[model samples]
Structures are given as structure tokens and as C-alpha cells.
Target: MEEEDEQEEMYEVQEILVDPKQKAVRIDKFVTDKLPRVSRNRVQNGIRSGSILVDGQPVKPNHKLSPGELISIVIPRHGDRPDGIVPQDIPLDIRYEDEAILIVHKPPGMVVHPGVGNPDGTLVNALAHYLSDTDIPVLPGNDNDRVGLVHRIDKDTSGLLVIAKTESAMSFLARQFFDHSIDRTYQAIVWGAPEPPDGTIERNIGRHPRFRQKYTVFDEDEGKVAITHYRTLSDMYYVSLCELKLETGRTHQIRVHMGSLGHPVFSDEKYGGDRIVKGTVYSKFKTFVERCFALCPRQALHAKSIGFIHPVSREYVHFDSELPEDMQSCLDRWHHYVDHRRANNQLEP
Candidate 1:
């Protein structure tokens, strides 16, 4: 699910008012002093970006701040910060937590970390706040924004993610992912039933040439090797529910592979699943499909389960989550349509 997607710039403007009894000080110094994590260089960078404004006008980094003046600091919500991650009070659906690890259910449309268009309001920001009071050490070699994170899913792919609370734990869990020793299963609603009910897709995946934000399958000599094993759980003919397991975790591996097999994951706009791929061309069918799209506005894929070896206990641990409401609602609609068609002896050929 972690694919290179287009990003839109977003800014978080923070306004500060000079204290009544404050002395005239350089703006950069004032900013670094006023903000907890803001550094002098970051303030200067913000000034250069015209993000630091005094009285609604951009000022030089050495501009003197006077009492009662309103200073606005506009910082990109993304990972452009030089200081560290910003902690926000965002709620998290924590599934499991211990000394060495944490598991959480990420909802659809929530970015895993701060980047590009999503600089703030991410799962990492939430983790920053959640662990603010704890003594959990940040992962070695990782940015503070991605402190405990070892893996990431797409913004729209709802699922469970494992987080490492300590450096040793981080290395331990990361090794499992690198070795493909981690067990992961995803449930996706894809267009049409695959030819072989159960099969494996082995292909090389790389970023598209023209569309840098998107990915495409490539020759063996080209991109990275990716493997996905899928089995049909239910076949409604026009669309089927599938369970996919990964042998290698590549960006957009499941989506790209399913798309290569002519079974794009339902509602995956980037992979052509947002249209009527397998259903009839009738107006009624179109309406039904459109309704389903509205129900699940994002890709109909869920990371159902994950299994890994505990870093502390060395015991195997597994976690599972139910399908989110949007996906479940979309599937229910498809089930109802299929049942109605079967009852009328008009099921699609």
C-alpha cells in the first residue's frame, strides 16, 4: 500500500504574539526561544520560504520583534522540519502493546507518516503524542517522525501495523520483514474472478516512467522482484473477494499484481478499478457500481492479519482485524446484488 503518490502542499500556520513585557529581539532567536523544538536554522528557513511573517508581512531573519506584534510561522506539515516530529492529539485504535512492541489498526485515508502533502495529522504524529510520556527510545537511524515505525501501508489501505518500541526491537522486527519471515494476509475486493482460484503472481515492480507517482510491472531484469499469493474467498462473477499473502513486500505489490492479472482492487482509482471493469454496461449496473464506489471511496483492501516473532519473548505473535465499515458495506451491497440476480435466474454469464 505504500506507493509513491501525488502530493499536495499543506501548511500549518502557527501565530505567536510578542509578550507585552518582552524586549526587542531578533525574529529567528525569538522563534527558537518561543517554540519548544524550533531551531534557529529552521526559523531562518521558514523566513526564506516566506513562512515567517510579522504583522502579515514577510520579514528578514534578523527582523526585530516588538511587543504586541503578531508573528505567524507557517511550516509545511510534511517532513521538511529540521527539528523533530510534531506531536498531535490524534486518537489511535491500539490493538496491542508491550515493552518491546505496539500494534495498531490504521483507518483508511490516514497517512502513516509525515511526507509531501501529509506533513502532520499522521499515525506517527499520534504515536509521538501517545508515547510522549513513555521512555521508549526512538528507532536507530530513523527520523524522529517515524520513531517506532518499521513498516507503512498506503493512506487508503486500512490495516494493522507493528511498531517497535526500542532499538533492539526495531532491528529484530525489521530483520523479519527483510527476510520475508513475517506472515501477512490481506483481504481485497478485486474486479472479476481470477482464472485460477488460487495462484501466485511473480513479477518485477517499478515506478512508471511517465507517471512518477504511480507504479507498473516490469521485466525480470528491470525492477524489484515481487510475489503475491492470492486465493478467491467469494466470487460474485463481476467481482470477487480475495485473500492475498506476500512473499516480498514491494510498494503497491498487491494492487499492481492484481491489476496486471486484470483484477484491479475495487475502488482503486490509480489502477483502473474505479470504473465498471467486469460488470454489464447497462445504466442500472453503472449506477450500482457508482453507489458501491461511494460506499468505499478508497481501495477495498484490508490487512487482515499479521504474524511475527516477538523481539523480547522470542514467541510467535499474530494479530487480526475485522473489515472496516466502508469495505464491509460495499461487499454487502455486492452480495445483495448477486443474491437478487441469482433469485431471478439472471446471474451474469
Candidate 2:
């Protein structure tokens, strides 16, 4: 039998100092309150495994905090964390490349990094292979598997992506993303035209309680704030093409926000855009819609453009990509459908 490759485990250490005015709180509660996404149970497990320390000594979950004490926690890198990423001979659409940065036009169905289920053949793997001859430094204090990524789009959403070739460049671009200075615009075909045509969507987004794989809008106190500004570009009656600008980037922010507005991206299966949301019940219309879906098998969303300050040159740079063939063909089909209907006076007033 062939020897199986064991998944590599990585650990990250975080340290915190006890405040002078801090009360005697349990270590588990203190760590949970400090870490936003971490749960108390996980912290307790780490404590049980001797992964948590106080002033260089292992501590229990119920250990009481004292003023002027140092606390340290060793966290396992898992859950969307990349293991050992093997270099693969995957093709990449290089839009722009320089010594410190590279802009890639990511195609639909390409994962940005390695994660559960998708362990290979990702953009990162391809980048690793392409950069094997060069000295692409691993990001400091990050998973080595993701050496170049500053930001990412969804797997099935095609568009422009900027990659950092150096640690300084990565830090500079990551800061831009944190400050919301990086300009990113996406083009999407949605099921219905948004009311008023142009507007901003401000909602909190978090993982759904029932559907672990899906995200949903939540109360302000429950989830992180997400904002998206959008305007309709073309109205095809049942569907509308729109341009969306993200003010804040959250997981599934665009998809969840648009779904909340009743205009999910066309053919987004996870968010209920696969079924006809705005069309007649007739069998012919259903068949036509199915054909349109077949034309663009994935969600009709594309990262059309991105702009940011160059980390090394300190000059502003922008890049744009034409719509992928799949999405373009789908839009052309819709345009032809609309035009033919209008010519025959079949469109509703």
C-alpha cells in the first residue's frame, strides 16, 4: 500500500498582559472574551492539553487572573487553515507582475488557498510552483501555506486578485484592506432588480446557526458589520446586472447581503438563486431559465476591477478584467432574450 501523507499540524502563540484594574476572572472567560471567534470550550480543551500558560507555566481553565501577570495561549491552526500545500502545475492568468507584487486574474472554480476538501490545485499551489525559482518569503506570523495572499474572493467567483511577493508588500496591502482603502468592484447578474436601482446595504453577517457552511445576516450585536454599495447596470426584467462596491469584507458578504435584499446572485446554489426567483411558472420559461443556468453554471459574480497603492513603488495601480466567458455568455443570452421579447411586443409594460 502507498504511504499516506499525514496532515501537518501548526501552532500559533498569543500572549496578553493582565490589566492593573482587572478583576479575578477565570482564564477561560478571559481568553474567550479576548478572542472574538474562539469559543470557551476550545479554550478549555487547550488548557486541558497544557497549551495555555501563565508566566511560562501551564495553567488550567479555571485559573484566576492576577494583576500584572502575563498569559500565553498556544492555538492550533485548523478550520480553514491550510496544511502543507504541494506545488502543482496549474495555469494562472498573470495580469501584471513585478518584483514585489503580482496581479492575477483568477478564473471561476479556482480556490484561493488550500482548505478542507480542497487541498491542492489552488491558486496558492500554482503560485508556489511559479515562485519556486524566486525568493517568495513566507508571511511572518501566518500559515506558511498561504505565502502571498492579502485578500481573497470566493472559489466560484472569477476576478482580479493582487498578490504580495514580499513580507513588506503583504503587510502594506493587508493594512490597506484593514483600512478599507483598497478599491474593489464586482459585476454580478442577480435574480431581481433591486428596488430604487442604487443603494447601500449595511447589515451584520455571521455564520448561520443551522447551516454551518452558509452565512446569513444577523443582529448588530450578534455579527460583524458588513456594508455593500450597489447600482443596477442593466435590467433584463427578471434579472438585473449590477455593479457592487464592498465597504467591508466579510465571508459571503456580497452573497448574503444581496440575498437579504431579495436579489441573490443568479445561479448561486447555496443561497437559493438556482431556482427561478423571478419568472413565469410556464414550462417554456422554466426551460429557458434552465438553459441560462447551464450557460453560467456558477454564481454570476465577477471581481471586475481592483485598485490599490503599490507597496514598493508607493504609486497607485489599478487592474481590470473582462468578464469570464461563462458569465459573458449568460449575459449575452439574457440580452438577446430581452431584445427578442421587446421586438415582438411580448415584454410586460
lDDT at 166, model 2: 60
Candidate 2 wrongly placed segments (more than 4 Å):
1-83, 135-143
Best by lDDT: 1
Off by over 4 Å in 1: 2-81, 135-143
Candidate 1 local lDDT, 1-349, one digit each (tens): 5422111122334789889998989998988887756556656766754556799786888898899999876543333346678878999999999988889999999999887888799998888888876776644323455667767789999999998776556545654665478899999999999999899999999889999978899999998888899999999888999999988777899999999999999999999999989867889999999999999999999998999988788889999999999999999999999999989988765
Residue 42 lDDT in candidate 2: 57
Residue-level lDDT for 147 in candidate 1: 64
lDDT: worst 10-residue window of model 2: 1-10
Judge candidate 1 against the unseen true structure and give its global Cα lDDT, from 0 to 1. Answer: 0.81
